[model samples]
Target: MLVDSYGRRIRKLRVSLTDQCNLRCHYCMPINAEFMEVNRYLTPKEYGEIIAELVTLGLEEVRLTGGEPLLRQALPEILTTISRCSLKKISLTTNGILLHRYLELLQQHHILDLNISLDSLKPEIFTQITHGRNLSQIQTNITLAKQQGFRIKINTVMMRGVNDLELFNFVEYAKSENIEIRFLELMRIGQACQQQQDQFIPAQELIDRLKTRYTLQAQAMPLDSTAFNFITECGARIGFIASESQPFCGHCSRWRLSADGILRACLLKTDGLEIRELNHEQRLAAYEQLLGMKPYLRPMEVTHLMHQIGG
Candidate 1:
């Protein structure tokens, strides 16, 4: 097991299957940059092996992320492998474009936690922010996912001038559908890094605005959600990821694995130990090195694309 400077045991692992994504969001990229090439990605087998080892090292929760995980053909295979492992929970954080196509396989594997990236309820705004994605398809997929009886979450990146007004609209929409909505304070990274200082709005303001129309409050963890700890006065709840506003670095029980096999101490850390370069024996030694790493500092921000980190 690996313990950081704060004595937090790293257990949650976010595994990036590939840096390639089908949609291009401005916050995630410039909306015209290229995706990771095929050869640069990790194969299903290699990733599974890493997770199997990671589980042995006290990793209990695993999230399958990608620019779009479903874009990869062997995605279901990877899901099944992770589900079969001793990890307590296995979930997927996706853009939801390809979810409807494989909802059954997901349910069959008992991988129910699904987080979808949806910034706007309006189609035009969706297209503008995500470059070329169709808003109608995402809406339809969200509806279908709920009807299918899967635990679903809508992850919204709260941009100041961009989608701030949509906040209340988004909450009303989630409340109507009875789905958990998370208002995330956008993290500045990569091409979106510069915009962080300009675009980021603290979660406190979002809750203040929502309180005008609703009597909601931030809920505690484990009971509310591992991802979102909340309970609403209206009998519904919303999640606010205050990564920048109120850093959870102390209790941050998570780590990220780049698609190419880099074990990042934190997304903001410019450097990481590359486990993929080592042999089997060396890989075990590498895991030990991870035990010596410091707690992820909040100001130490991620430099790569969100897709590259498996957003």
Candidate 2:
């Protein structure tokens, strides 16, 4: 098992398929973001082999992420490779622009748990935030996925004076759809650092605002869960990924693998260990070294963009 100095065993792995995305969310990357060359990313077979190796080392769950995972052309092949592993669960995080196109393929591989990023319910606001014009389509896809029995979670980056006004709207949607909605506080990483001071919203502030209209009962979750979940009186499930307001580094059992094969133990760390060419034994050794490097406390900031590190 890959255990850190703090005794936190790594059980979850997030693999970034590529650093290319269709939408340009300001907090994640610049509108004119320069992406890495396609040739630099680990091939589908390489990703599969790395994930298979990690599974043997106690990685139970794998979450495929990216600048936008759906944008990767080799996704089907990658999924086919990973489906051959002995993982307990395989989930996906996407912007949902092209999700409708791959629903069938995802289901074929048993990847039903999905975390879809949706910052605004209003089309104009969504376009304003993401520089994309497909809010209606994304909403339709969300509904379609739900109807198809996919466990869906809506991930929203809660920013002050930006989308904070729509907090109750998100709660209502969650209640009506009977889905989980997670509000993430903006982090001071990459391009987001410029606006973090002005846009960051505390999870407690949101909870206080929510308490005025709904009674939220704290829900018990696994120790390794990044989100602190709660259920409303109206049967709505909500969660707060309070990275800034309330850090959860103590029980963090997750690590990330960038599309180009760098292993990161913490989101806020600037450095990572590259393991692209490592054999099984060499990769195992690299995993141990990375685990030892895991920080006991969350760092104040990071130089890397969310896309670069596989958010």
Candidate 3:
């Protein structure tokens, strides 16, 4: 087993398929973003090899991420490769814009757990946050995925002046749809760092606000879980990823592999071990090095963007 000095066991791996995304969310990307050359991304075969090795080293779950994973042309092939490994669960994080095109294929690969990013329910607000106009289509896709028996989780980054007023709206949606909605605090990373102060909202504040209307019972989660979850009086589930106010770094058991095959032990750290050019034995050594590099607490700031670090 890959255990760090702090005794945190590495059990999950997050892989970025590409740095390309269709929507230019202000917090995640710049208005005019330039993507890496296609050749710089790790190919499906390379991903399969690395993932197979990581599984042997004690990785039980793999989550595919991206600037937008669905934008990758070879995503189906990548999914097929990952499905061949021995894993307890396989998941993907996407914006839900292209989910309709790959729903059947994802089910075929047994990727039933999905994290969809949706900031707002209103058309204008959604476009303002994401700089895209697919609110209606994404909502339809979420419903379709639910009907198809997929476990869906909605991720919303709560910005104070932006969409903080929609907290109750999201809670009601969660109750009506019987799905989990996770509100994430704005982090000091990349383009988001510039607006973190003006937009940040602490998780405690959100919880206090919810207590006014509903009773929330704390839910038990894995020690390594990032979100602190709760069940509402109405039976709806809600969660908070309060990376800023309530950090979970001591229990973090995951490592990230960027699209370019750089392995990062901490999201806030800018430097990582590049293993794309390493052989099997060398890659194993690199993993060992990374395990020792894991920090016991969250860093004050991260120079890389969430997408660059495979959020």
Candidate 4:
């Protein structure tokens, strides 16, 4: 295993395939955010080479993330290429707008695990949060994905007063759909900083609410996992990523790679080692530098936004 100086074995890598997306989510991307040029990001072959190397270095899971991974034109090809890597698990984190367009391609590539962003179930509120008009389409595609044997995991960023009222609604939806749902605490980074202070909601609040009505059985999850998993009374699996109220940095065993090849040791940190132009030996040295600099815990303040850091 690739153990850092801090003794955290780095086994999972979150690779941002593209820093572009179709929707302008309020908490993730800024309304006027400038995206990286397409050519500036690594190509599929380059990603394959790097990922293959990482896999050999004890990387067990690869999760392709993006501003919206599905928006990348070469997504199918990219998935197909990365599928060649000797990794235990492969997944994608997407906004789910273009999921239907890539459903067949995904199945062809055998990429099944999906962590989809769905902040709201109400049409108007969904539009308000995502600045997109495809809530119904997203819902349809989610259903389709489930029908096609994909393990669906819905990720909801809970903002106070914005969609906190829909907490029970989301729980009910997850229960009815028989899908795992995780409520994420709104981190004070990037576009989220521009949001009103009242908009921020702690994961503890939701945990308290859920506990009031149901029995929450604490369950074990993967290492460096951000979420605290629980099995609810209604058989719906639920989780909370309380990064703000209760930091889980001590157990963090993963790292993030941006589209342009910046290696972020921690999401709360802005400065990172850029490995886009590095050679093999140089890249390995840079990785060591990042691991050496990895903090034991995140600081009180965070300035980088979700999209900028690769959510």
- Judged by lDDT, which candidate is best? 3
Greater TM-score among 1 and 3 belongs to: 3
Model 3 is weakest, by summed lDDT over 10 consecutive residues, at: 302-311
> Candidate 3: which stretches are off by over 4 Å?
none
Name the lDDT value of residue 22 in candidate 2.
92
lDDT of 1 by residue, 20-139 (tens): 777888888766777767777777677878888888878898888877878877787777777767888888888888788989998988888999989998887888888865788888
Ranking by TM-score: 3, 2, 4, 1
What tens-digit string does per-residue lDDT give for candidate 2 at 1-311?
Answer: 88877889999999899999999999999988889999999998998898888888899999999989998999999999999989999999998888899999999999999999999998888998999999988888999999999999999998888899999999999878878999999999998999999999999999999999999999999988999999988899999999987999999999999999999998889788999988888988898889888898889998788899898
**Candidate 1 TM-score, C-alpha based:** 0.93
* Global lDDT of each candidate: 0.79, 0.92, 0.93, 0.86
Position 64, candidate 4: lDDT? 87
lDDT of 4 by residue, 217-258 (tens): 999887778888999878988988888888988878788988
- Each model's TM-score? 0.93, 0.98, 0.99, 0.96
Give lDDT: candidate 4, residue 302: 74
Error of 3 at 215 (Å): 0.5
Give the candidate order by descending lDDT.
Answer: 3, 2, 4, 1
Clashes of 1: 2
